[model samples]
Target: MATLLFHLGRASFRFRWFVVLLWVAVLGAAGFAASKAPTPADEGFTMPGIESQKAFDLMEERFPGAAADGASARIVFIAPRGEKVTAAGNKAVVERLVHSAADGSQVASAVDPFQAKAVSEDGTTAYATVSFAATADDLTDASKSHLETALDKARDAGLTVEVGGDALATKPSAGGAAEAIGIAIAAVVLLVTFGSLAAAGLPLLTAIIGVGISMTGILALSEAFGLSANTGTLATMLGLACGIDYALFVVSRYREERAKGRDPWEAAGLAAGTAGSAVVFAGLTVVIALAGLWVVGIPMLTKMGLAAAGAVLVGVLICLTLVPALLGFWPNAVLSRGARRNSRRHRRKQLRTENGGSRWAKLVVRHPLPVLLLGVVGLGAMATPVLDLQLGMPGDEAKATSTTERRAYDALAEGFGPGFNGPLSIVVDAKGAADPKAAVATVSKEIAATDGVVSVSPARFNQAGDTAVFSATPSTAPTDTRTQDLVKTIRDERADIESRSGVSYEVTGRTALNIDIAEKVQASLLPYLAVVVGLAIVLLLLVFRSLLVPLKAAFGFLLSVLAALGAVVAVFQQGHGAELLGVESTGPIMSMMPIFLVGIVFGLAMDYEVFLVSRMREAYVHGDAPKQAIVSGFRHSARVVVAAALIMIAVFSGFIGAGESMIKMIGFGLAIAVLFDAFVVRMAIVPAILALLGHKAWSLPRWLDFMLPDIDVEGEKLNRKREVAERVPEPVG
Candidate 1:
C-alpha cells in the first residue's frame, strides 16, 4: 500500500498543474450542478415501524384531510392584569386574530378560543388554533407574514399574544459566522504548529476546497435522493475538520522529510506514502462508523451519516493528491525560517533534543501505575452523570426564551397546564363494530379515564362515519418521564379497550412520535455500538498487528465517550453552568445525542489512537526498545496530534453559537469528547498502559498474524527498498 501511494504521490507532484486543474474543474462542475438542482426537501423526524408512525399512517388512510399531519399553530393570548379575555373588547381582539389567521394563505381553518372552549378557568388566558393545509416545510412566506401581522394587531389591542407550533417552526439560516470563526482558530493553530505562513495556509486551502466540492455535490444530489435541508450541516462540520487535519498530517510529514535533507519531490512522495497511509486508514474508520448508522433504520440519521462519510472521503483524497502537488509548487517556502537557515547536521541535532512530548512520556513511563489509575479515576468520576442521563426530543420549551415559540409555550403551559403543548391524537377505527358511534363513544370514555389523562377532546367522526379522531392531553410535561409512561399505558391497554368497545385505537401526534423515536433510538444504541466497536477493533488489529493495542484503544474510546456524555448531561440536562453556555431551559438531552456522540467520537478517538500508536509500532518494528519506542512516537507525533485535536475542538465549539438547541448540544458534546479523548485517553492513559505492558503490547497470535494481510501503514517496505537502492550505487549510472 505504501509503495503504491508513493508512486501515486510522485506522479501527482510531477504533474502538479494537471492535479490542480482537475480539482478546479471538478469543483466548477459540482457548483454548476448545485445551481441547477431543485431545493432540498424537508423530511422531518420519521420512524417507520414505531407505534406512533403506524397510527399516523392509519389516520392518513382513514381520515385523509383530517389526518393530524398538517401544520398547526397555537396563538395564546393573555390580557393585562385585572382584565379578562372574556371582556367585550378583549373578546373582539381574540376573534379578530382568529378570523385573520383563518384568511391567511394555505390556512385550512382557525378555531375561535371561545367556541373551542380553549379559555383558562379564570378567563384571563385563551388560545386559538389555526390549521394549515400544507406541512410546516411547505408553508409559504406569505402565510407566515399574514400570521405575524395578525399577532402585531393583537399586541396593539392590549393583548399579549405569542405563537407556537409546527406552522411557526422555521429552519435557522446559516450565517457562516460559525464556520468562519472555526477557520480562523484553525489558521492560528496551524500557523503556530508549522511556523511558516505558506505551510500553514496549505491545509486551510485544501480543506476549503474539499468542503466546497462536497457541499456543492450534496446540494446537487439532495432533491433526487430526498435529503433533508439540514443534511449538509454535519457534512460541512466534519469536512472542514477532517480535511484540515489530514492535510496537516501530510504537510508535517513532508517538512520532517525535508528537515532530513530529502529534496522536494522525494519528500512529497515519502510523506504521502507514510502519512497518507495513516490518513486513508483513519478516514476509513470514520466512514465505517458513520455508515454504520444505517443499521439504526432511521432515514434522517442514515442520510446525515452517509453525507458526512462522503465528506471525510473527499478530505482523504485531497490530502493524498492535492497536498503533495501543492508541496511541489513551493518547497523551500514551506519550511520555517529556523529550518531554512539550519544545515543538515544542525537539523539532525535539533531533532534529537528532548522536547516536551518526550519529557512527559518519560514521566508517564516511569510511573505507569499511578498515571493509569489517575486517568481512570478522573474519567470515571466524570462519567457518573451518565447514570442519570435522560433522553427526549427538545420542544419549544427548550427553545431560547426570546423566541416567540418559547413565550407561547410558556403561556399555554401556565394557563392550560404543561400538557397543552403536546397533545396526543387518538384515532379510533370502528368499521367492524356492530354500531360504530357507540364504539367511538366507548373508546373516548375509556381513554379519558386513563390514569394520566388530563382531558379528552370531543371525538369527531370522518365523512365515512366509521372512523373518529380526538386528542388526549397528559398531566405531565412533554419530556417528563411520566408522559412517556402515559403513552405506554395507553398502548398497553389498547387490547382490553378494543375487546370491550369493539374498536381499535392508536395514539399518535407530535408528543407520541417524540416518545416513540426516543425509545427506538435508545433500544438501538447497544447494537449500534457493538457493530461500530467490533469493526474498529478488527481494523486496528490489522493496522497494528496486535490484539492488546486494539483492545486498549476501544476501552479508551468508551471512557472518552461516556465522560463526554456525562458532561453534556451535567450542563444540558442538570442545568449545571447552563447560563454561561446560554441554555435558558434544561430538561432531557436530545434523544439521538448518545448514539451520535458514540459514533462520531468513536471514529475520531480511533484517529488519534492510530496516528499515535502507529508511530510507536513503527519504532518497535525497527528494533527500538518498547520504552524508547513510546518516547519516539510522542516526540514525532505529539505536536501534530495536539494541533489536530485543537482544530477539531475549535470547529465543533463554534457550532455552540447556533440558536438551535440540538445543534448546540451536538457541538458541545463533540468538543468535549475530543478534549477528553485526545488529551486524557490518548496522551495520558495510552502511554502509561503501553509502558506497563512493555513488549507484550505489540504481540499478536501467530495464526492470526499469518492470516492477516500486511497493510504497510508505516512505509517500512518502502524504506527498506530505498535503503537497498541507496547502498547499490545505481550500477555506476
Candidate 2:
C-alpha cells in the first residue's frame, strides 16, 4: 500500500500545480456565495416556543388591539430613600419620561402603555409599563436609546431607573463582544496551526461561511420546525467549531505529505488515503455519537443531536472536496524543503530496534506492574478534585461581563428578593375540579413558603385563572447553587402540589429546566461515554490486531481525562485562573462539557496512539523485537505529537485569555487534555507499559487474528515499499 501510495504520491507531485488550482477555484466560489449568505442574527427573528409570542399571536387573532398598540418596554424605577412617593409624584415621573419618549409630542403615542405599577406592595418601588409602536422583535436602536433618554429624564426628576426584561434581552446586537472574542481566538489558532498566514486564515474563513450558510438555513429550517433563538447561536458556533476542526485535520495532513517531498497531487492523494480515510472514520464517529443524543429521546438533546451531526457531516465534505480543490492552485505556497530529502533509514532502524530493545529497556520492559500501579495512583490523585465540580449550565443571562441588564438582574436579586432573576416558571392548568382558582393560589402560597424562597410574584393573571405562569425566585441567584437547590425544593414539593384539590401544574423554564436537563444528561452521559470508550477500544483492536494496544490506549485515555478534569477543578472550579483568564469563576462546570471532552480527547488520543503504534508495529513486522519497536516509535513520533500538541495548546488556551467566561472551560479543558495525552500518557506511560509487554504487545491469538485484516500502512509490496520508505539517507532531526 505504501509502494502504491508512494507512486501515487509521486504522480500527484508531478501534477501538484493542477490540484492546487482546483482548490483555489472551489474556495473562491464558496467564498463568493458565502459572503452573501444570511445569518439569523437579524431583528425579524422570533423567539419560538415562547408563550408570550403565542399569547401575542392569539391576542392578535382575537382582538388585534395589542398588536395595533405594539408592545411595552418595561421601565423600572426605585424611589429615593426616606422619601415617600405619592400617587401624584409617580404620575408626574411617568408623564415626564413619557413626554421625553415622544420628543415633546403627545406622550400617549410614544409611551401609550406607560402606567405607574407597584413593583412591590409598598409605594417605595414603582415602575412604568411603557408600550411602544414597534413589535417586540422590531424595536429599533433609536427606540431603545429613546427609552434610555426617557429614563434619564425620569432620573433628572428624582427617581432611580433601570430598564430590562424580554425586550432588551432579545436585541439582535447582544453578545457581539463574546462572539467576537470567540471568533478572534479561533482565527489566531487556525493561522498558527496551519503554519501559514493565508492558509490558516482560510479554514476559519470557510468555517464562517459555513456558519453563515448554516445559520440562514437553520433560520429557514427552524421556521418550519419551530426551533428557538438559543438553537440559532448554538448551531452557529457548533457549526464553526466542527467545520474548522475537520478542515484543519485534512489540510494539515495534506501539508504534512507535501512537506515530505510529495508533489501537491501526490500529497493530496496520500493525504486522502491516510488522513482522508481517518477523516471519514472520525466524521462518522462524530455523527454517530451526536446522533445517539436522540436515542435517549429528549426534545432538546435530540434537536441538538441532529443539528450537531448535520454540521459535522457538512464540514467533513467541505474539507474533503472544497479544501482539496482550493489547494490545487497553491503548489509552492504551502510546501517547504523537507519533501526534497532522501529516506532516512537510521531513525527507522532505531525505531524498529525498540521491538528488540536492550538492557536499559529491561527496566521499562519488566516494570509493567509498577508503571500501571503508578499510573493508577497518578490518575487517582488528579481525579480527586473532580468530586468538587459543581455542574451547572449558565443560560443566556450570563453571556455578558458588565452588561447593565445582567447587573440589574443581580442588583434586583440583592435588594428586591433572591429569586428576582431568571427562575422557573410554573404553569398550572386547572382540571374539572371546582374552586380551581383557590387551589392554584394555594399552590402558589405553598411555593412562596418553600425553603430558599426569596419571594414569589403575585399570582400572574389573578390567582383563580386556570392558566398561570407564576414566577418563583430563590434565595440564591439564578443558575447558582441556590437556584439549583430551589429547583430541587420545587421537585420535592411536586407531590404535595398534586394533592391540591382543584389545580395541577407543570413546572418548566430556565431554572427547572436546568435541573431537568442536568439530571437527564447525568443519567445518560455514562452510557454514551461507555459506548464511546467501548467502541474506541474495539476500533483500536481492529486497527492494531492486538489486545495489548487497545488496553494501553484505553489507559492513556483514562489518564488524559483525569488530568484534564483535575486541572479544570483546580483552575476553574477551585478559582485558580479566574483573573488570569479574565473570567469570574462560575463554579460547577457545564454537564455536557465533560461528555464532550471525553469523546473529543479520546478521538485525538487514539489518533496519536494509532500513528505511533502503527509505525512501531511496522518495525516489529520488519523483524525487530517488541521492546525496540516501542522505544524507537516513541522517540520518532514524540516530536510530532509535541508539535501538534503545542499547536493545539496555544490555540485552545487563547480562549482562556479571551476574557469570556462562557468558553473558558472548553478552551482550558481541551488544552490540558491534549498536553496530558501527549506527554504523560502517550509519551511516558503508554510507551513504558507497551515496552514491558514485549512480543505480547502485538500478539493476537491465531484464530482471532484470521478474523482481522492485515493493514500494511507501510505498503502491500513489503520489500519494494520498504526501499522507498527507508530511502531517506539521514534522520529527520
Tell me model 1's lDDT, rounded to 2 decimals: 0.89
Per-residue C-alpha lDDT of model 2 across residues 1-733, encoded as one tens digit per residue: 3444445444444565664465456556655654564433322222234333343344344343533565554556666886534457866786677667666221235433234344555555544555555555667767667667777877888877666554455433323455456456556655554446656665676666666556555555564455555565445545665566556655666765565556576666665455444455456656655666554435555565667667666666666555665566565454322222324652353235333223333455567667667766776787788877766666544445456555555545544565655666666666565776687788888888888876666655433344555777776766577777777777677787768645666656555655565666667767876776677777667666799888778877887887788878777667776666655645667767776677567656665676666657766777777877765555444444454556556556655554345567777888888888876676667767776677888899999899877655533344454457768677778
In order of appearance, the predictions have TM-scores of 0.96, 0.74
Clash tally, candidates in order:
0, 42
In terms of TM-score, the best-performing candidate is 1
Runs of candidate 2 exceeding 4 Å displacement: 1-95, 98-138, 155-160, 169-284, 295-379, 395-401, 454-465, 480-486, 710-733
Could you give candidate 1's per-residue lDDT for residues 587-623 as a string of tens digits?
9889889988997888788888888998898889989
lDDT of each: 0.89, 0.61
lDDT of 2 at 339: 27
TM-score of model number 1? 0.96
